[model samples]
Target chain A: MASSISTVPHRAGLGHRLWQSRIDYLFLVPGMVIFGLFILYPLFASQWFSLLNWSGFDANQAFVGFANYAELLQDKYFWDAFARSFIFTLSTVPAQMAVSLVFAIILNNKLLRMSALFRTLIFLPVVTPVAIIGIVMTIMLSPFNGPVNIGLLDAGLINRAIDFLGDPNLVLWTLAGIFVWKWVGVTMVYWLAALQTVPAELYEAAKLDGVKGWQVTFFIVLPMITPFAIVIALISAIGALNVFPLIQSMTQGGPYFASEVMEVYIFRNAFATLNGAVPRLGYASAAGVFFGLAIMVLTILQIFAVRYLRSREKPNGA
Target chain B: MALEAASSAASEYVIRQPLITPRVRRWIVSALLAAVCCIWIYPLVWMVSASFKTNAAIFASEGLIPSQPVFDNYLRAWNEANIGAYFFNTLFVTVGSVLLVTIATAMMGYVLGRRKFLGRGFIFGLLVFTMFVPQGYTIIPVFELLSMLGLGQSLWGVMLATTGGSFVIFVLLFAGYFSQMPDELEEAAKMDGVGFVRTFWYVMLPLSKPIIVTVIVMQTLYAWNDFLLPLVVTLANPAIRTLSVGVYAFKGENFVDWGGMTAASTITIVPVVVLFLFLQRYFIDGLAGAVKG
Candidate 1:
């Protein structure tokens, strides 16, 4: 895409000097200025604030060399949150990706008559407010009066009613389950879109050889959308790492901090960790920088892997 | 002997099986799919049902339809979530941001789509790159930046900050609703010596309805469903709180208002639900374009 765009010839004339168009610059200025002030400057602030010992307040002024990072290294909660975040990324990304891919495959089968309706129904969760989902999941996962427990108990599936949010062992998985439920549809949508771009002729070619449905799906469909599947997986993984608001609304990183993730920890550290949950700017900033770096490294590695595979396949097929 | 000989001769004929038959297997598959659909739709359906349920029914019944449905909870929820104000704030922001971003992106997309330039490669990359960077990665920076601008907790700040969402613009251009124009129309316009602005105004904009509609629906959804930005930046002020934030607030402040809470949630979901059911063809099409682009 980039190479094609780059090869387009540049015409230099009063009529054709596109850059000279005042409207272009005018359109750009508002977006650029806002992004620079809000997004770019704050990105630099992580480095600046990392150097300062000032708590996350504007009025305070103090300079301490590497103390924030040093303190963070010693923080047990930080490590715990990092571990939990990773665990979530591990569990949720693959489950969500696998489930969504399966769903996409099932829906994308030509034999399915109501593909559009199925696609739309699956995607409804993506459109709804995340907060509302958080609320519903909280109520539904509560041990008492929660339908999950009631149904399980009614069917004699469990000897005991499980407190999903209360048990440290279960809380994270519960959260992961909810996350999958919320996100799998979104992944399916991306996969479905990518699936449509696969030519029908590929399937016809494979079918002519007497290949079964699953074989055709695995060999032909999967490889064609490998780049997209990888991209969506990485995005989901990153989202899991940065998850907070749902944690806050549902578990509040609770059941003895069982469900704590990096983003939730960062929020708690900043706005609610100490002193009636007063803001701890310096500490939170330092943590944010730490987690941000960790996430950036993870995301970049995934991107490179995707790109490598994509290009490797490109010589043969897109 | 004759019958036996005929049966032996016809033994080569095999029983053929259809992919799906109107039988027990079909019944099981449909039943299974129906059960799964119910499970999938359960939470959302429960939210709607619970909103109509009385306090006791909400706490007690897990029925598909409320045992005792009533609208009183919804009425109370309107007051309880402070959601009336939230709706106003959210609507204003969603609409206002869509307007600002769409218009700017359209003009930008139009120019970028139509014009050829050096470093256009870089500009398009820069625009597309924003979509990949999760807003959380930049929230702290964005928050601090908003605070510095003295627009902290202000609606306009939220509107402006999200202006970098060039997605709609990017999609519109790449989809090339503009570029797909019959070159003859543009050639004829050029022959008439119409200025570029006049050409875009009279010709391109009129012809760009499919993409423009697509962008409008998509950006509206983005601006509506976005949670974290408001969660982070709008900490101090309550006036600018959107519907999602308001729902979050209700959950936090009032613990036992399950009926009221889901009621408020129902209100939060109403516009999107209606829009989705009614305007879905375009919404799905637009969303497909976003991912597939």
Candidate 2:
């Protein structure tokens, strides 16, 4: 049916063809307007905002040519936040992918009954609000009387309650663990979908070859789902870098800026005053532009990397 | 008779040998996964249980079941935090944004998917590229844009802001669905002398139920759970705050009211969880399609 429709001649002129498809243009109008205004415009407009010295409240703003960028280059707090953000991303993405892959592999087993129930239970956190998760975790991980501390003491793992969110050394890792807990379900689902696409014949053939379970998983399953693995990694990395409300609700980047990440840093500078520091809208905009461009570059690199990997694999009959 | 019985037992042993290992292994794995699932959902279960417990019980007991359940937390959370007002506000924004996004993206998706129009690829590419851009970085400008348009501090502004942020996801889902749809129905409508808009409104729109549901479910969760946008845009007006922002404020104001706070948090997550439970399949499929797209 599609072939027949495509084979029909379009003998009309270009202008006439466009005119005939006026309804299509009309269909696109509203989405385009909103997308252009809210999303696309912000991509460039934020860069413009980054160049100015404005408090985000005053009307008279100084036209500082690259001054914010210059200041951003020398700012230690900005770089510290950036490093912390990278750490959060690095820690969570791998942990999430690893745990989720295991879950996906187990759940993919044909003989696993009540799989639906397990999947729903695991995914419950994903649907819950991040702020709420943060709040709950804050309570659950409280140093003195939190359930986690109580459980640890009861289990004889520790004699004293450790301040999970209070200690500078432990805050970031705790936050990363919490992030993995919430988001592993999402990555697991992605892996499950990817796992289903792997041919049954391959697994059967491997079994016929006397391949062990771990070997089959590592050699056949892992390589087969590499594309999805890479995509999941990139998505999680990007998401982790943008962690905000979780930090806000839980720590507010407290304990001497130990848990501070790029988004929270930007939020602090742009809107809220934290620890007696004044709001720096211009500096935050500059930092935002920097991080935004960094993400764009990372995405482009990922696209290239994926294409390159696919190209390399195609010769081997991928 | 002894020899015959021995042979039958030997045969049964061989058959069981081949099957017993994997069946046992499968059960072990299922049991392990069930344990992991409990750990994963423990926080949420704990939260719900704690919402019912008295403050003393919440701190003292680490168990799932409450020793003595009380309804006071919910009452205080509802009254003190003005949760009812915030719930209504969240519902209003979520519904408005979901409806607007569904219609707008459906129309856009139809064009981009089914038609070979000028600049379609370019516009689609632009939209896809915007997906990678960190939206958190742009909140300041978005806040300014909303204020400039005089929609700031209003639920309508929050709705509109949320609409375009993830607009690409719905568009991709809808476009993928529409592209795969058979063209014969639309062609038949054309043969009957129906106009293009009529064909879309009557034929294509009606046929887009699945994709529409996916979009609605996904967007509803997003708009309902969203915090940062509403946080920034509704800063001036406390009356227009959504559940998330209101709950955050509740925490800030009553720093020690963990009971009430947990109660409010429970209230905030219930609607999304209920909707997800009802539309579980669509939610999973939509998420898969979104990531793949």
Candidate 3:
């Protein structure tokens, strides 16, 4: 049954339709107000703010049209941080998707005992606050008497203690590894949901056919779940970009700016006055707007991709 | 007779061999998974252990068991670091935001999902459009807005801004759920002469338990763990900091106080962990629902 007033005939004008469902329109007011105030307004205001020379400290502000954006274009540090954000995403998203896909497969096994317990264990970190995880990891990965370093040394895997967060060369990779650990559960949950879409009857048929486990997985299950990978990858890439809290808590983009991602860069420019440099809210806003535009483009691309996939799948009635 | 018996025994041996291999393989997989799970949660376990240790002991040992346990770190984090107050702040903000989002989204989703009225597509399109807009960059304007409204240094501002996220995902979840509800329920409510608001309050809201729980679980984790918003909002007022911001601030101040840091971390983490443990099913369902939406 179509409850929508859209079922009304074309003869019913827009005014009549709206009058028929005035209460429905009223229901939307609160959400719309909040959205306008918080999201829509901020969205435009940020673009406007990017054009000014404001320190975010006082009212002594001046309008500087596109100056911040100009500086951003030439700013080596901004470019490096932007590249580093991509680097973090490139490194972590694949690793997280691959690893979590494996866990999802394992837990999806009916023969596996206590799969719920294992799933819960892997997911515990996801529920735990990232700020807390970063702090705990700092201590847990400390070079001296840290659990991870000690375990590595005892196993003869390393000749000396490794500074996971301190060494500039290793810090970004280290953060990437921790990023995988902290967020793997989320990707795993996605995989688990995708895995559920695979029909049980297909697995049963494979068993009856005497299909080898590996062969069945590669031939049957993989193809069935392949469609979900694109969406899952997109989600993961978005999540990977949001490593601000984790990085902030763990190292604050330290060790001589080796691990500074875009978020850290934006934050430092906007709020932090480090090394006698003044905080530049306008510059940071410009950087943010630039990054936001890039994300918007990516999202548009995603929309097109999703539309293409859906169109392709529709002929197969999938 | 001897030949027949030997042939039967060989068949039985073949059957036993395959069975034994699978059983052993299962044992191996279980053992491996168990080990990995232990290593996965080791940091959390270590955090708890380190919280009980003195700074010297924490530095001297890598063991999961503390060499000498002490309550000083807890006391220090609670009193000196003000984690106790932050705990209350986090609770207040989390509950307020959850309630706000829940009520607002329920109303919006109920209307959008069930009643296709004028401007519905426009509103819905706007919601979906904003979802693509990266939220991290929008903080400056939100901060400015709050400051202009004189909520710059208050927990109330934190609550409002935190609730004011482009929660299109949650709204979609609610919309999807409401759309699936039986039409007869609303039909019956209308027959009883129930008004629009009363129908939602009395029928739709209660019937949408799964969606409500999903929204609450996800929003609680978000509001509880949200660092950036709380950090920026409460930057001017130390007294109103949430656990996340407070813990970060505590870490910054006591860089060398590993013991105290761990204690603060433990304090910040325990409640949510406990909440997850109790509502683990709901959390998984919520996540799955979110992905599906």
Candidate 4:
């Protein structure tokens, strides 16, 4: 996109000496100061601690060289969490991408009335806090007298009530389904916004070539919106990594750690104070640093992969 | 592909397409979509309906609308539950964080967007890098840092913990507006010995409204609904709990109150929902900004 639009900036600055220019960046101090104090500082500070053996307090801390990272590597729970998070990202992202894409196509049909109202309703769950979502899902999916189970029972769908969150065997997939429902609409909004930008003329041309319906969707619409698709995928990936509150409220990583993602595992060990003491700050910090690095690597790889694939495409070739 | 599908569908239909006209098809699709939409929204409707019902009526009225909608649940949520106090606390914290994020990110964004300073590219990359840093990965250090800074177990700690948000800084990459903005008004103001601060206040601030509004809306929503921050840092102090935290407080160790929970949840979300209804246009526009990679 940048290469395609490269040239002169429409809002030209005077090409005078850099020092002599009137564009003084000194005006940006107050905001920078806040970001520096709160955000930028904490990250580097965390990295510095990742190399130390401090239990989150400075008084009796020791600078243990890579001991935290070494311990993290050997920790069984850490690897379990990493694997669960990968499974979560795998199960949720592609399903959400597919459903959200269908929603976008339906909304963009132009002839549909009440689409705006439907879009707004679909987007309601996006702004609802994850904590509440957890409570609502837990109650609704409860085995006895909960509306969901009752509806299924009345329909003769099941002989006995199912523990959606309590059964370890069926828990992760159940959580995945709820996660998809909550976010699929959010992703649909992104898709709808991106879809509007795809010009109508391309569709008419495709129709003239005897292309319509699913053929037009696959051949014409999909390729045109690949850039937007890549963006939504990255957003979904980042979102899955932070799936904390919903799990914490509903299950608390119960059913023998079957659904524990990295976020919850870190919180449980680092902040919960559940076993009658302060959470393991140093070890948890190491886990956090490890996960952060992994995310950074994944994001960079995704960007590179998308760019290379996009470049390999011969304009519109399949 | 077209021939395969078209021929199959045509041969499969036994009535030879003697059935529905386009008008009937349109109405049928609309009605079907409406039913699905209802199914989609049933959870939300059920929640609201349950919130208005008495304890027995909630379980009894499960099949349809509440038989006799009562206001006691809402009253209990408002007064006894203290959701009102939590709402105020949440609004204050969220507004404070959003202001801090916007002012800080905008100033930094401006410098990175408009200035040719030292390590400009490095700073820009660093800011972008922060976007991928999740709380799951940052909370351990953050919990330590907040306590070390004497802000833990307080509302202020919650405010400070969200400072590194990258959503604000990313807005700076689209500095086309700054490069495009006419300097005549600022030049005239500066010619009168108006310093950078005064010039920014009287001139530059007015012009950066679009992006500023976007930052405000996005940050406000995040701060309003944020649970993990308050949950982690302010657990010891119920007084410091935000609306999100207050809603979770209704969950007891022995049992959960579904009616009270939904009542609290409804109360908690009303403010954000009201804000969304009011700023529907600006909210979408702000969200569109986040969508731009």
lDDT of each: 0.69, 0.82, 0.83, 0.71
Runs in model 3 with CA error above 4 Å? A1-3, A316-318, B1-21
- TM-score of candidate 4 to 2 decimals: 0.86
Q: What is the lDDT of residue B236 in candidate 3?
A: 74
lDDT of 3 by residue, B1-293 (tens): 35323433322222223345755766777889999999998888888998999998877774678766799999999999999999999999999999989888888898888887778888888887777555568788888899999998899899998887537777888888888888899889989999878999988899888788878888888898888888888877899999988988888888899999999889888888888888877767767766665
- Model 1 ranges with Cα > 4 A deviation: A1-23, A110-113, A205-209, A315-318, B1-30, B110-114, B118-132, B162-192, B199-214
Model 3 Cα RMSD, 1 decimal:
5.9
Best by DockQ: 3
- Writing each residue's lDDT as its tens digit, candidate 2 over B134-206 gives 6668888888888888887788899889997568867877888788888888789989999888998999998
| After superposition, candidate 4 runs with Cα above 4 Å error | A1-25, A52-57, A208-210, A313-318, B1-25, B166-210, B289-293
Candidate 4 lDDT at B254 equals 18
Rank the candidate models, highest DockQ first: 3, 2, 4, 1
User: Candidate 2: misplaced stretches above 4 Å?
Assistant: A1-17, A204-215, A275-278, A315-318, B1-20, B291-293
Ordering by TM-score: 3, 2, 4, 1
> If both were scored by TM-score, which would come out higher, candidate 1 or candidate 4?
4
- When summed lDDT is taken over every stretch of 10 residues in candidate 2 chain B, the lowest stretch is B7-16
The DockQ scores of all candidates, in the order shown, are 0.24, 0.36, 0.37, 0.32
Model 4 clashing residue pairs (backbone): A31-B104, A39-B164
Clashes in candidate 4: how many? Answer: 2
Tell me the interface RMSD of every candidate, in Å: 9.7, 8.0, 8.2, 7.5
What is the Cα-based lDDT of residue B13 in candidate 1? Answer: 15
Q: Write the per-residue lDDT of candidate 4 for residues B37-141, one digit (tens) a residue.
A: 788867878888888888777766455577777888888787877888988888788888887777666666655555564356676676667777887766665
For model 3, name the residue pairs that clash. none
Residue-wise lDDT of candidate 1 within A43-156, one digit each (tens)?
Answer: 667667767766557678588878988999999988898889878889999999898887776665433445556666677777787788889877877787877788888999
